[model samples]
Target: MAKKKRFLKMKIATLIMIAVMLVITGCSQSSGTSVKDGSNESKSSSGTLKIGFILSQTGTFAPLSEGIINGFKLYLEKHDGMLGGKKVEIKVEDDEANPQVALRKYRQLIHSEKVDILVGPISSSVVYALRDEVEKDKIVLIDANAAGDDLSWSKKSDYVYRISFSNWQNGSSAAKYLANNVGKTAVVLAPDYPAGKEVLRAFKDAFEAAGGKVVKELYPKLNTNDFAPYLQQASAENPDLIYAFFTGSDGIRFVTQYKEFGLKGQIPLAGTLEFGDELITQPAGEAAEGIITGINYSPYLDNELNKQFVQAYEEKYGKLPNIFSVQGYDSAAIIDKAVTEAGSANSEDLIKVLKGISFDSPRGPITIDPATNNPIQNFYIAKNKLKDGGIVPEVIETVENVTMPETSPFE
Candidate 1:
């Protein structure tokens, strides 16, 4: 009996040792990587702030993610790789522009990584998916790009603050200007998505309020191979102008095809900022010329901060920064400012500091509206002009202090 007992004890001790080794090995293999450089520096140190980014690093939204990350890194480089005097560590996850994938990544960032703050997502769908989760987790999320209107309205949360413009702002910014200067009868078009529907609704409301009539509304399925059918419908309606909102490859195809259909000159083309932004206009080339848009940021803006930002961005990335880039830069700026003011990285403190925060951005002076946690800023009515063989937004009129309503129109 004594000999049997000794053998059983030895076997139990050996099994325990193997279990400990397995756990240590698993932890060692799962270390987080730095976003700036793909280095395994995951261990947290005192005075370190962990920021997790959920972005679409693949698929159609890759360019947007690239711009955002580049702009953010530039801010960190300028600030000695610190935010609010705390050393920063970042972890990025790609969502492929899918809401389900974004939610899974969000869980990893929150539960496993234990990130202090969150930022990112190019698509509004991703934003909507992460919204409830962030609120439940009580984590602060700086909305970098998603522009769904409801975010500032019925779905607004204390844990979330948007650093980028909303779809309501994008849609209504140029409505009055176009109605008064361009034409009274218009046909509106956008991709058939939540963003597209919300933007057009806002535009229709504001345009009609400004004594303009929307004679037709067309929504093409996102990533449509050919825009011929939609173009034919718009042409048949024969409105005075066509106002559109399409981004990524869809924007490129629509612009080129609009010109192909010979509707470019016959019917004026106006849209949200994407139509005039380099992302679309560069590829669209001459096809993007004469396109009028409501833009929040342009590399050509004559502002001191914008000038310096443009110079530095071009030096670092070798390209002119777009609206998305500015959004990312502002995201970093807001976090820095909020953390400094709050004097703590806790979500409770950050939330208090984020509300109604104002800062001079590469875009312009931006103030977060306390009521909705949306930006109150300027919008420019710009026309795409080919200057020196490059398309640029030439500001024609400035709409200053554009603000969202205290209550959602939907409500």
Candidate 2:
């Protein structure tokens, strides 16, 4: 009986040693990687402030998201990666341009990663999907590149703030320009999404108010590859001008196909910022030339800060910064300002600090509107021109203080 007891004790000690070895190996692996959707990319630093960045790393929105990340990092680089004298730690996630994936990434950023501030996944739909959750959790979400109108009005949360253009600003500004400068008869087309529909409505209201007629309004299904049929319908109307809002790959395909349909300059073309996005303009080549649009920023804007920003961006990213990057840069600037003013990571304090703050952005002087919590800044009516070097947005007119009214969303 004694001999049997000794053998059993030896076997028990051996099993205990193996279990501890497995645990130690597991710890090493966990420490080496991050807690994401099995992603290996990570950017961590020692700090009191943790900023979680959620944007696309794959799929259609990748280019725009890449620019946004670059811009955000550029600002931090200049500021020594320290915001408001607090060591800033950044956690980035790849949303893959999927709303469901975005939610999962967001939860990790909030609960698992424990980020103090959260900034974007550049899609209006994605932002809306995560909106209610953020409000319920009482987290700070600075709208970087998502320009949905609801973010300003109906579905707004007090904890939410926007540093980018609202759909109304883009549509109304372009509509006013088209009526006064372009033509009296117009046909507009856009992808059938919330942003697209809002653009259509805002444009219609402003154009009609200015004594212009919208002969036809077409909403193609989102992610449409073929714009030939839509272009034909607009041409059949025999309109004096054409306006559109196609984003991502759709934008690229529309501009390229519009020229192929031989309607390039015959009717004259104008749109919101998407029509002149660098991702579309450069890829669409001559098709993008002479396209008139309205936007908050253009790389060619004449300002000391803008010039410096463009130069540094080109050097670092090997490409011209577009509206996405400019908005991303501004988002970082806003966060810095709020954190510095509040001197704490408290959500209530940060929201108060952001409500009425003003700053001189690369685009121009901007302030957070207390009523709508959107940027009250200039919107530019620009024309795309292909120079010997490259195609760029040329500022023709500047509309100052373009913002949403306190009570808006008229039918």
Candidate 3:
């Protein structure tokens, strides 16, 4: 009887040991599976948040585009490559600064590459070409640099939003400054296109309304590198100031030659969208000094966020942040905010969250237009000044935020 009882006890002890081992092994396997699943989930989430960056990496807008890309990358890195807990991935494409190429690239990004968000194409013409496609796909497009008024007015859509202020706003602000502070007689020079026409009209309207006179207006070709002949004509006119609107390399050429021809100081200069960081301050050298231009951003903005951004950008690129950089940084911030508020990357959710949304940007507070998906932001009246052995444009005055007309003629 004692031996039988001892045998039963030994059997029960063995069964209990087997059960304990099984539980331990099961717990180990479950933990491993959980870790694996979590990593997979992270990868999957990261895969879903693909961002498409289309810019003119090799053409007329290269300098501005490079600045913009740097700003975007800096923001992502600062945030540790994650926004709202989703890993961020940027797919860059060069548009070659051509509208046709930009169209194809944009289509590929939307249909084939399947990017969740679209970020850029510096040229307004390029953006105009792809506006329809962007609207059709219902993909949100944050314009980082293009500031043509039509993008926000005539070609407006729910999916399109601009972080940059419109050319009209800049023109208006500049016109007001020239009319009120500077002399009245002015000569206007811009590219021969809709953008040029719009800026000229906006400036003329505002200046004339302020009891100023536009002495002469000239529309030059977009890619014209030689501005001597035109500058001579404007110089002959002897206006109190010249409101020039050339961009890219042409801007540098215009300012440099304007100085070479001894037009500096004799006739003060003012314009919209001409004096960006890449062209006016750096490449134009001392010639860019004292040239007043209207812009939405300046490196010397008195804001904490902007200061940090400029510092990080200078550390990385060894250059001051341009308007394009400011706009691009704002674009990322806007998208991040919308994504966080919506709690999803769905188009509808993003659109709902972005409409009329406002956020602090390097250029001060920026708000989106609910009707046209445009940005409502303040414009700056800046003058180029030499600082730190480099030309640094400083904003001498801040222009009040100008809202677009409720009913634009283009719209």
Every model's Cα RMSD, please? 5.6, 5.9, 8.8
- TM-score per candidate: 0.89, 0.87, 0.86
Model 2 clashing residue pairs (backbone)? none
Worst 10 residues of 2 by lDDT: 37-46
In candidate 3, stretches whose alpha carbon ends up further than 4 angstroms from where it belongs are 1-47, 276-278, 409-411
Shift in Å, residue 132, candidate 1 = 1.1
Error of 1 at 55 (Å): 1.0
User: lDDT tens digits, residues 1-411, model 2?
Assistant: 999999999999999999999999998766533434322122222336778888877766787788788888888888888777777788889887678999999999977886778888688888888888788777789888777888878888878888887888888987877898889999999988778888888888899899899999999997788888999999999998999988778899999998999998898999998777787898888889999998788788899999999898998889888888888888899998997898766576788888989998888999999888889999889999989857888888888998787767584
Candidate with maximal TM-score: 1
The lDDT of model 3 is 0.78
Clashing pairs in 1: none
Please list the C-alpha lDDT of all candidates, in the order they appear. 0.89, 0.84, 0.78
In the range 1-411, model 1's lDDT, one tens digit per residue, is 999999999999999999999999887656442211212133333578889999999866788888889899989999999998889999999999899999999989887887878998889998999999988878889999999888888899999899988999999999999999989999999999999998999899999999999999999988887999999999898788899999888889999999999998899999998897878988899999999999999999999999999999999999999888888899899999998998877777788889999999988899999999999999999999988998988999999999988886755
Q: TM-score of predicted model 2?
A: 0.87
Ranking by TM-score: 1, 2, 3
Q: Candidate 1 vs candidate 3: which has greater lDDT?
A: 1
Which residues of candidate 2, in runs, are more than 4 Å off?
1-46
